[model samples]
Target: MTNSTRSGKRDRLAGAAVRVLHEQGVEKTTLADIARAADVPVGNVYYYFKTKDQLIEAAIAAHGHHLESVIATLERLPTPQERLKALVHSWVEQRDLAAKYGCPTGTLASELDKRDDGLDRAIAKVMGELLGWMERQFAAMGREDARELAVALMAAYQGISLLTNTFRDPALMEMEGHRLERWIDSLA
Candidate 1:
């Protein structure tokens, strides 16, 4: 296969793994499930990943890349405050999926935290990247307590995501998104 073809298959596997992991959680999602989801042969999964842990790592990396894309998109807005609000709105736009499967990154982190294998650290790094982006936005807005505000913002998102998933209610996420936007606007 050409390098582009190989890379495409790898990306397909990683994307399928993310979806399977989100839908079934890490414990229940198998490599075969991912392979089937990717429409690749079961053995082909081993071509890209030696173990389920490696695949999970790939999924986490994909989420990190996704977070970076989100940050890049937000950077296009004219003002820091608009960027922050846009960030919240972007997440809120995932309310339906959040209601169905919970926040993708948050749910993966929570599930991986249950294990003793230290995958939680990887999750923390991914979460930190998002928090750092939010912090920079707040700092650009002249907030002295940018880190604290960022933490609060993420806390609110995680909290609402948990509630939205538990209740299977998308409106809760929308409501919280509006509330967060207002809170962010109130920030200095």
Candidate 2:
């Protein structure tokens, strides 16, 4: 295949892999399934990603980085308080984005965690980075135990997302967001 054709194929497969992972979860997704979803040959997926784990890891990284970028944009706000509010709003919005792609990184990480320690460790690092980012923002506002606060915030988010997924209720998700907003507002 021409280089251009190869690149296009790789992009298609990667995009399809993301879709498949989001729909089927990491445990159920397969290389052949990804190829079928992408409308490409099975060999093509292998060409781009050596293993399913590689594809999932890449997908999670891609999704996680996209989220981080969105959060980073909120940092331009004047005060850490505003930034934190923006963070909360951005998170709710981002989870909606994840709904389009299926479950977010949190779900993917939870599923794959049992099967692969390496991938689990990698996911943990990504989560740590995200939490660390939040910690810095809280610390800027003179909040103590910013890291612990970040972890609490993460727990709140993960719990809300999981519950929302289970119930398929947008209102519940909104309530969760508001509850978290209030909690953070209290902190501020």
TM per candidate comes to 0.98, 0.84
For model 1, the superposed segments whose C-alpha errors exceed 4 Å read: none
Candidate lDDT (C-alpha), each? 0.94, 0.76
Compose the digit string of candidate 2's lDDT tens values, residues 1-188.
89999878877777777678878888788899999998998876778889887787777676666767867787778987787777777667755644444246687778777884578777777777778888998899798888899889888887777776776665556777778888888987
What clash pairs does model 2 have?
Answer: none
